[model samples]
Target chain A: MGGEYLANLADSLVTVMDKMAGLTCEWSEKAPQLPAITEGVTVVSLLGFTGAEKGRVVMEMDIETAQKIGEALNQEELGPFDKMIFYALSELSNIFCGAAITQINNGPRRPGLRLTPPNILVGEGLEIFGERAHLETASVFWEGGLIYIHLSLEGGAAL
Target chain B: MIREHLQVFAKASSDVFASLGVQAVHQAPLAPPDSFFSRYDLAIIVGLARDLRGSVVYSMDTETALALAGQMMGGMSLPGLDEMVKSAVCELGNMCAGSSVCNLPGLTADITPPTLITGSKLAIMAGSDNVLMTEIATSFGTVEVRLGLEE
Candidate 1:
């Protein structure tokens, strides 16, 4: 995957987050530090994509940040780490992934990328494997908290 | 129809575990649990569409998940359910569901991405009552498999 494709994908994610959750997000100029598990309870959602590009996109944030986003979207206070909050986060990740894939395949070269339903992980001390792959990470500041979006493209070129 | 589907799923589960070098034996089918809460701490739900419209949930406790993940990673010691372990478990569920769909002849359906839920005393409402519940005994621990299909 080209850097331009990854940049477009990051832009698309920010757009979706802004529109869906009413949260202002932009790609951080400098690489932000990944939150330590001890900082708070973290929730990570993974969505795998296949077609012209094969890899996984991960959305990570603290539980408090997730609840805030969910409450804003639903306009209701949600319990910390509640199932509803998890579902909302999952749906948000789904939309973000869908939009990013569409943005990547918008040009003349169609990736024909298809996304799988999101898989969510709610816990601390989580580490994903993609060491030998092309990894692109984007950190966005939202409402004083940071949301990390990582795209790991593995062994696929734009068709 | 349910039995046929169960057979495919059971074979798939066995094959997946065998591939990971872990022996898993199909146990007797059990009655569906009234509440998923307090039953297991970690669960992976794989949604199926088309000919069979529903989900397949693989439930196990935290220890079982850690053990399974360790085995999947060639017996690497895991302190907690980190990202790597979680991904390994999710991939296992994906593989099992993919194999089941492939083995079930004439069952045209698509598999959704696997969803992993981890918490204590969690409750999940199935879409339908038509569920095939079975237990599998593995060297590490027991895994409860619930296949819920919409009629």
Candidate 2:
């Protein structure tokens, strides 16, 4: 995938976040750095795409950031690492990826992409990898916190 | 029927471990849902659809995850859970779920890609409340496999 496609996907994600979670997010020029373990709990949600295109979308942020967003969506204060928070995060990824796929399919060269349900991962220290893939990452600032969104496409083909 | 399906997962876990050059002994009867503790630090969840609609979760601690990753990488010493190690762990869960589904007679199912989660006091809430869990004793450590099928 090209940078333009990634930018479009990031834009779609931001729009979804704002609309669904009521959290405002802006794209950052800086890239995401490796998260330090001292930063507390981190949640990484992965949603894979198959069918016309093969790729995966990853959304990573700290637990505090997730809780804030989840609270906004749920309209209540959520406990730390609550199952409701995880479900909210997973649905956020799912909706974001689904919208991004629609944007991709609208392009001239449609990959006919279809998104899989979001898979939620929560941990203190984590590293994610995709085999035979090309990765495009975008850092976004939301509610005084930084979150990273990564789009990894398999086989290095342009979609 | 549920016991029969659970047995398929047990067999697949043993076979996958054996193929990775590790010995995993079955603990016989499956564990109850409440018996599953939240002490595990890492978990890999795979969703099942079609003939079987639910999911399978493989839970373990950091030690077990690293050990299993090392075994999968041919005894490579892992400093921590890096990208490579995480991928390996996810692939292991994917293989276990995929192979188990194949063993079921007259049953067809499609599995979602495996997802890995690591944290303290973590819990997996599957679609169904009725879960059948089994413990597998491996050379490195113990892995608890939970199966949740919708009625």
Candidate 3:
């Protein structure tokens, strides 16, 4: 995995979070590991990219943090995790993924990648698995809470 | 368009299962759409892009998943959802989605690697509420394939 690619993705995530949700978040230097949330609800949103190269971006966070971010984006108090909140988070995931892929497309690789609509999964004690691919995991944190991003670039057109 | 896509997907699934030496019969979608919460314990979601873009989710119980994966692995008796089992299941999803998109005459699309999710009380929203779901009864069990393509 190229550092420049990772940097572009991380920068896009930070910029999008700050600009879209008015939330200041940064990619942590700590080793990327999916957090263990044995209890409580976890919200995971995934988007895939296709073109010269293929990959995916997964954004995951606890429901409380998701609701808080939703409130921030909607600029109003949300009443108990409803459909609006789910849409807000799903759109946020789309924005984050779009930003990251845009940066990559404009970068040196120029992998004219197109995005698929985001899929939002809400559940408790959920375990996600995507093996046999090059994976790069990172964590993004904000004042509200933290979320994990997993990027997997599978076999496709050379990067 | 939705019905056409569903038919293509069903045919592709039947072909894939036939190639695997398994008998899979496509049936009408499971009725009373339960919205998002899935009744099955395992789901392999594959995102499609280009001409037909959205998601194709293969949902089934653990036993069905194990049986399908086992068939893919040359009829091996799988125990649980181990790493190998999970990989095989994802590949099965990849095959089904890939085949379906390719068979969509006059449309060219690509599929992202499958994302496998397993747990209790699972609810999934893929792109929109307009999802076409159907069941394929195999010798192993019933597998539901959900096509949530963006209009």
Candidate 4:
């Protein structure tokens, strides 16, 4: 149940990212190709959930690729998110956690819930901690297309 | 008031990570509004529920963490988990939380335990946030972190 929920969360997130950033966003059952380099641009953002359950939500992306997303914020569609990786990454996390926290706070079924701003991770040659689950997934694109991925950590904690 | 303070601490987190050449996205990026459990590895997070109403978490993964510790030690190769990484990751959380205490609007917060998660087994308790975790596509695999509130 928890794992399924995590996957669903990832899907919902894809929706939000697509609507806000307009990346032609989609998920993929096929694995995402991990290039030798992280495409010279990756935006990562996360939020903290405290009380009872603890961990964080982190989002990563390629900068050059991000720039290609043209989501109109105020009647202005920006170019590739490559240059604004940091800004795009942080703001995106904020949005994700903001909604998550709100739901947690309001859900009677949920236990204690709280959230913090996303703490972004930036660098080159970052190593993977564990086996990549959901490495390949069925993704629904805003364009009603489909995509795949190498993996997506969605929400997880080390045991 | 608490919101503003949270912002300050959020910036502090970014600053610390930036020093290590990482990014810390705050309330803007959307950390997955519909997911449960904000994810972080080897992190120390605290809440300012009383005077101020917000929380903060400091994070780093295995590789980047070791690298940061190595840099602190003046270019020493981090073969594996060592005291350097432990202290660095912990202190990062401490600094961010503490800085918020002084920098934020109205409140003081105490520290909390720093939980370290390792291996492939990750536990994500059911959760959904206003914003989803920010996805970072990098040369390596994707790495993400998030902080959320329940107000």
Best by TM-score: 3
Q: Write the per-residue lDDT of candidate 1 for residues A25-135, one digit (tens) a residue.
A: 888535543333224466776666666655667677877888888787777988986777777877787787778778777877787776655555555444344422455
Of the two candidates 1 and 4, the one with more favorable DockQ, higher being better, is: 1
For candidate 1, write residues B44-134 as lDDT tens digits. Answer: 7776655776667788887888888899888987888777787788888888889998998887766656656665444443324576777
lDDT of 2 at A27: 94
Pairs clashing in candidate 3? none
Candidates ranked, most accurate by TM-score first: 3, 2, 1, 4
Q: Which stretches of candidate 2 lie over 4 Å from their true place?
A: A2-5, A33-38, A105-112, A156-159, B1-7, B28-38, B44-56, B65-91, B104-133, B147-151
Per-prediction DockQ: 0.17, 0.25, 0.82, 0.08
Return the candidate ranking by DockQ, descending: 3, 2, 1, 4
Better of 3 and 4 by lDDT: 3
Residue-wise lDDT of candidate 2 within B17-99, one digit each (tens)? Answer: 98998899987578567733456878887767667766788888888889889988889888898788888888899888889
lDDT of the candidates, in the order given: 0.70, 0.74, 0.81, 0.44
- Tell me which of candidates 1 and 4 scores higher on lDDT: 1
Residue B41 local lDDT, model 1: 70
True contacts kept of each: 0.01, 0.08, 0.83, 0.03
lDDT at residue A146 of model 1 (Cα atoms):
74
**Tens-place lDDT digits, model 4, residues B1-151:** 3235445655665565556555444435433434333344443444344344434444446676676556656667878875456655555555556665676555454333233333222222211222223333222223354444444
A118-137, model 4: which lDDT tens digit per residue? Answer: 44433333222212122223
lDDT for each residue of candidate 3 in B1-151, tens digit (9 for 90 to 100)? 8778878998898789889988988877644246788888789999988888898888899999999899999999999988899999999998888888889989998888888988778888877667878888888888888888787
